[model samples]
Target: MPLDRRSLLLGSPFLLSGCVTSPATQRPSQAAISRPDMVEADYASIYAAVDGEPFPVPAIDLQEIEPEFLRRAVGYRTAERPGTVVVDPGERYAYLVGEGGRAIRYGIGVGKEEGFNFRGAATIARKAQWPRWTPTPDMIRREPQRYGRYAGGLAGGAGNPLGPRALYLYRDGRDTLYRLHGTVEPWTIGTMVSSGCIRLLNQDIMDLYRRVPVGSRVVVLGSGGGTAV
Candidate 1:
């Protein structure tokens, strides 16, 4: 069958291959590897689709999501060479510039005003599947009651706010402490709610996670936002 978004997002977690960590070592439980299906589920149940399945993306209501935010290929003209990631935060889109004046675009959720803007160049230093999350010291200090419990770290899982994948950004070989990662809340896409990380819908993040190579270049435009890979 011709590949569709559902197949790309819902068929195989290994669709791209070589990006996954050993399940035995990364997942907290077997259930995290294979879980239940999501059927006509509400937004709250979205996490059920991603909890621990080998193919963890769930079908979301496209009608509810803006068409521009959905992943698609488009004719794009840019000076940046192919394989570069360009993020336009003001417009809320991330583009993977491809060969021949084309680009793959995905809608993104950005950080709030405090974490909303940064300018400069960075590289994809690392990638992780279902990455562990630690509330930053700044985050804890700002909201202790909310972030204190997870200060040490939260294991990768559906319940973890980072969702199923993370691309760590680096500049000059130093960690930026920013990430482009999956979000448990699909509805959050195309919004600005996060502290500093760039968030994509879980399925979209997985799609992006597979395409981006380690050491890829990422450019955040104007006052926009993006992690790295």
Candidate 2:
């Protein structure tokens, strides 16, 4: 059978880590409601296709996605400083902390298995545009027919699972093997699907890439209490 998005995301490699199992309760504050000034055309432009890249990123069909999962600014209550990245897996959301209780929020697709999720603080040690992807030894061992052909690694391109950009996460100068990356499967946002990586829409990740830099802090919150790895 040909490899599909489900195969690619579910079989992707990630280092095992602890995560909280409780559900999240916080929603966007009333102050952070959707911008009334933003019309349908605004969303169209926001998810529009781009021209300058190694590969063409097609526009997203908004109708295919729930409006709640679209990118937007929201009122977030957090102690993290501006430029910090906070991921709440239970909520299927990620926040780019900003000044004055505000944050730019993006919908995210997390690991399907709770045990596969990594909860803790990390740093954006590296960033890549259209990064390469390689299945891990364990993944290959378990599913050789699915991952064996790509032992040499898959190149960055439109067909690659990492999509257009990737933010590499690390701790204490060591790679954690977790990533905040883009996905071509836009409809997967706000769901539990990936092996472990925190995935965002290609357009959203590209937008985040422009604003965040290497060395930025990242905090992945636990389901109930905010726990750190």
RMSD of each: 12.6, 7.6
Lowest summed lDDT across 10 adjacent residues in model 2 is found at 17-26
TM-score, each model?
Answer: 0.72, 0.83
Task: Flag regions of model 1 displaced more than 4 Å.
Answer: 1-56, 223-229
Worst lDDT run of 10 residues, candidate 1, spans: 15-24
Count residue pairs with overlapping backbones in model 2: 0
Winner by TM-score: 2
lDDT of 1 by residue, 1-229 (tens): 1112232233212201111101111212233212211112223332224444543556565566776687666777778878788877777788887777777777887755633455567899999987887755665565577557767777776566667788888889988777788766667678765655777877667767767789999887876343323
Question: Can you list the residue pairs that collide in candidate 1?
Answer: 32-52, 130-164
Model 2 ranges with Cα > 4 A deviation: 1-41, 224-229
Tens digits of lDDT, candidate 2, 50-114: 66787988888889888888887777778788889999999888888776677788889888788
For model 2 the local lDDT of residue 65 reads 81
lDDT of 2 at 79: 74
